[model samples]
Target: MNFSYELIEKYKETKGYTQDKQVISDFEEFNSGNMSKIKKGTRHLTANQCIEMANAVGMDQKEALLKLAIEKSKSKEEGKIWSDIVKKISAACIAGILAAASLTGQVVTPHLRYRR
Candidate 1:
């Protein structure tokens, strides 16, 4: 499930903002009827809309919402960028592990190396 959706639902349920009219009033940027549809799962929010909703609801954790929006709004090219980043990180980790192993391999046995 989308993190933004989960967060919205959690907030609405916890804060007793279950009514469509109330939600619409609280988040005035959205259409009145759409609030009910969104709550009913018949409609969904885009990343930007979700962030706006979160802001309207006075959620203090803006960074979390922003990250979710970034993730949700990713285009195909953005996804490729994330994938490339993951690949680069994985390559670096592998290289680090190989370097560590090579260094360990060069360690002399206890009898061959002097101990302090």
Candidate 2:
């Protein structure tokens, strides 16, 4: 899966894995063969492996899982549905971030915050 490839890329950069075999060895339950096949988009990481990857790479677990779902879909139609949902989730997350960053902490209102 492309997402798996991206994860491996991030892992390589962050953890200094120099080869596909090295990355595969670092994670449990993954075949060294598939690590190389992933670059060709002919292999997929298991769902649990996807979660592990997301955690390892500091990515959102839900997003990673959803993207994996898209890749795992049995049909293009099914993939479309998953793809749409992932896109909406991504957009919503971005909107939430933008809304929060817009003015949430920068403007001090009369209401007291309780961080202390």
Candidate 3:
């Protein structure tokens, strides 16, 4: 993941206007500790740490996290919807079988439903 100093600066500018001292304190603490330890000088933003800092700055961490979550949810919902469709098709097939059996003058008892 790419770290944008411009973006961070923009977020800082936006977030700095707030009355939240805790955020500024946390940013200072992170800069003094973890951020300072990275030797790559500004090129060391990992995906996880970006997420952490985004949260610290009161930015849209949920929106970023929800990217993956939304995709997973969409996939799950799509699978479920198609599974229900398949189930409906299977039920239609069963109904067709029962109709065929009835038309053949056979005694379509409830026990015959077990054939499905």
Clash count per candidate: 0, 0, 0
lDDT of 1 by residue, 1-116 (tens): 55555666765775688755655565546675665565565566655666665665666544444445445444877756655665676699888988887788954456667789
Q: After superposition, how far is residue 50 of candidate 2 from its true place, in Å?
A: 1.1
lDDT of 3 by residue, 1-116 (tens): 22334334445565664423433364544453443433234344445545765676665764434332332334678657655665676699889998898899785566534554
Best-to-worst lDDT order = 2, 1, 3
| Model 3 ranges with Cα > 4 A deviation | 1-74, 108-116
Task: Assess candidate 1 and give its TM-score to the true structure.
Answer: 0.40
Q: Give the least accurate 10-residue stretch of model 3, judged by summed lDDT.
A: 64-73
TM of each candidate vs. truth: 0.40, 0.73, 0.29
lDDT of 2 by residue, 5-106 (tens): 887788787787777787777777777677768888888788888888788889888988898888778899999999899889879998888778776674
Pairs in steric clash, model 1: none
Considering lDDT, which of the candidate structures 2 and 3 is the better prediction for this target?
Answer: 2
Candidate 1, residue 82: the lDDT equals: 58
Q: After best superposition, candidate 1 residue 115: deviation in angstroms?
A: 33
Q: Top TM-score: which candidate number?
A: 2
Which candidate, 1 or 3, would have the higher lDDT against the true structure?
A: 1
lDDT of 1: 0.61
Superposed model 2: Cα runs more than 4 Å off? 94-116
